[model samples]
Target: MINLFDTAKRILNPFFAKRHLLGDDNLFSINNILSKTAALAFIRAIDKGIKEKIEKLKDIDWTKDNTLPNFPKSFLDEYGLEDKPILLKKNIIEKNKLNHPDITEEEARRIIGNALYKPETILKANPNKPAYHNFISRTDDKHSDIVLLELSDEKENYEVINYHIINNPARDRKVNIHKKS
Candidate 1:
């Protein structure tokens, strides 16, 4: 089986290496000289590889009680929380699918898991709802941001109440979360 990452690195290494020599402005000019078909094929291979990875990560059964582990120490310490059990209720999962028909239930769950575990930006102590937090992370496509609302009353057990994807996190007024300074 061909390793897409290695293949991509091999193909892209030269372009990256030439950046210092050719300078940033002329670097991307190489693409204009390369065959468009090859570029399209490379993009397709990357897309397929990403989809396969996402499919593999869908092993978690969303219907059952799943406790996500490995809370980043920084996240835990900032929120004064522990690596406790977190639940994604079936109704919320169904609601997420209903709201975002572009993605499947498994994909929704996967996004939720990603946001919970590997959030790029977390907005804690939501101004409107003190018990709720917003965990924001990039989707697999990196074209959109997935935002998850986690509710924790006693700080022992948590539940994901809502989730949605924003097309542009930079322009989205609803996404108040910012990168930690």
Candidate 2:
């Protein structure tokens, strides 16, 4: 007689198995688009903008043609990513400061390049603290995804914190933090 458990798995196996039908390279490509380093860069740019009271993310001229931003030659050389088209946003948040007071472009890019890849979710958003920027990053799927909140001070920048991989980061993720663009 056929076992009941075996029969059920046989019927359900096709559905789950189909998910991995694509080759490994395809999966890698998808992940590359949301590279942890890219996310780190994205967060750093935002932090710099907010610290300098720029507030609006859209206003920053991060991309010329919705493509990569122009990076400094020193940054490119230090990272050994000269061939890579990806670069950090150029405009400084503050007109007075040529660069952000907190982190250098090189340090920011390196932080992105070195961040660990891990998926996370926004557990909380706090706008009450006028002196600090607070948010929590966590994932129900794994404990490894937990990350500390990003504070307003330069010392608590996301670059220094462990990077988080947010899968469905709808526009609402940072909605409360930034004013409407």
Q: In model 1, where do residues sit more than 4 Å from their true spots?
A: 1-57, 124-126, 140-142, 169-171, 175-181
Q: Give one digit per residue, the lDDT tens place, for model 1 in 1-181.
A: 2344444444564555656433336645444433556655775765555455444446656566445443544445555677666665667767766777788666675676566655556765346566667676766443444555566656666777777666664424445433321
Give the clashing pairs for model 2.
none
lDDT of 2: 0.33
- lDDT of all predictions: 0.57, 0.33
C-alpha RMSD between model 2 and the true structure: 17.8
After superposition, the stretches of candidate 2 with alpha carbons farther than 4 Å from their true spots are 1-85, 92-99, 114-181
Per candidate, the number of residue pairs that clash is 0, 0
Q: What value does the lDDT take at residue 89 in candidate 1?
A: 64
Clashes counted in candidate 2 amount to: 0
